[model samples]
Target: MQFKENQTIYLQIAERISDEILLGHYAIGARIPSVREYAALVEVNANTVMRSYEFLQTQGIIFNKRGIGFFVSPDAKHKIKEYRRNEFLKTELPRFFMQLYTLHIPMDEIDSMYREFINNLTSNPSNQES
Candidate 1:
């Protein structure tokens, strides 16, 4: 995955792995790619991948199995959601708000747009069927 320069590469890699877990790509208790394998796949150094895995472990998103490889923690999905929500509030939301400010858009207008978007999403037949 292409990583942004705003954060460390290892952090971005961990976020990518968390996203994969959230999306069910890596189920709970599933074995994840080894540090060397992930480094080769993402074309990064093994140390970088190890750092990412360490971050995930600290966050309780995954755990090392000693003699075996790393496995997804049972709380991985919930942890991923919490992490993304914090990130959205801390970073993406601020950027979005700044963009609105630069565009001279009123807060009420933004709120209305958001509500409309949510309403449309909820009311869409395809989405409702899901």
Candidate 2:
């Protein structure tokens, strides 16, 4: 719930909520805390939380119920997964590739390393295998 100074508070709030939903702290179709409640929990202004909720609604990650609090969307899990995968590909992968290039690692060598990592991970019985 700690807000980053350079980022908008509303976007930070939205990311927190997204993390909750993705972690199953907020189950699919389950009601979310009220805006005032979340604001209280995060020690932020109610307007900030409201803006976050509205942004999430626009993303189809949550839906408002008449006279009730918002609920996690029915397709929330899938939507969250898709969103995270897109983010990983768009953001994380590029950075990783950049690091590999800086290290003078060839594309084939990187592929082989990745495959070995995956194989080692899958074969390790004590690792819980993700």
Candidate 3:
């Protein structure tokens, strides 16, 4: 996976894992790939993936078994949604609103566009794939 410049590698890895969970790639209570395995797949250091796993564990997104591996929390989807919503509102919304204001975009137009986007996503099966 390509790492973004704005965030640390571990955090980016954590976000990628979260996205997989959100997309149902890793279902609730399902075992996630081991750190070493995932590191190889993503071509990152194992330690980085371990750090990402630790962060997820702290956030209650995943839990570690003593001798086994990490598994998604039963309420992972809910937790991820809440976490992402908070993050979007805190970080992304301000910039988005600033752009809208600078462009003199109407809220009604934004609302209409958002609705259309959602409709298209729901109607197009191909768009649902990662």
Candidate 4:
């Protein structure tokens, strides 16, 4: 994953892992890759991946099992959704609204585009995958 200069790498990694969970790549109660394994996959240091895992653990998205490995929490999906929804509302929505206002774009146009986008998603199921 490409690291953004503005955000810390560990947080970005945490987000990526959250996304994987949402995508069903890691089902609830499923064991995730070890910190070292994931570090190799993303080509980052193991400490960075450990930090990401720690963040996720603090968020109750995942938990470590003694002598085993980390697994997704039962309510991880719901928690992820809640956090993302809040983040989008608090951060992304304001930026989006600003852009619309700055560009003098009408709600009607955005609604039409949104509808079209939804239609396309429904029409092409494959497009929904990463």
- Give candidate 3's error at residue 13 in angstroms: 1.2
Query: Which predicted model would earn the best TM-score?
Result: 1
Instruction: Report the C-alpha lDDT of model 1 over 60-125, residue by residue, as the tens digit.
Output: 889999989999998888887787788899989999989988999999987899899889988886
For model 2, the superposed segments whose C-alpha errors exceed 4 Å read 4-7, 125-130
- Output candidate 4 Cα RMSD: 2.8
- What is residue 88's positional error in candidate 1, in angstroms? 1.0
Lowest lDDT sum, 10 consecutive residues, model 2, at: 121-130
Compared with the true structure, the alpha-carbon lDDT of candidate 3 equals 0.94
Tens digits of per-residue lDDT, candidate 3, 26-59, equal 9899999999999998999999999999999988
Kindly give the number of clashing pairs for every candidate: 0, 0, 0, 0
Q: Give the TM-score of candidate 4.
A: 0.74
Q: Select the stronger candidate by TM-score from 3 and 4.
A: 3
Residue runs of model 3 more than 4 Å from their true location after superposition: 106-130
Sorting all predicted structures by lDDT, with the top scorer first, yields 4, 3, 1, 2
| Model 3 residue 27 CA deviation in Å | 2.8
lDDT (tens digit, per residue) of candidate 2 on 1-130: 6678987999889888998988889998999999999999999999989999998898889999989889999998777678778879998999988998889988998789889988887898677522
lDDT of 4 by residue, 10-102 (tens): 999999999999999999999999999999999999999999999899889999998798999999998888888988999999999999999
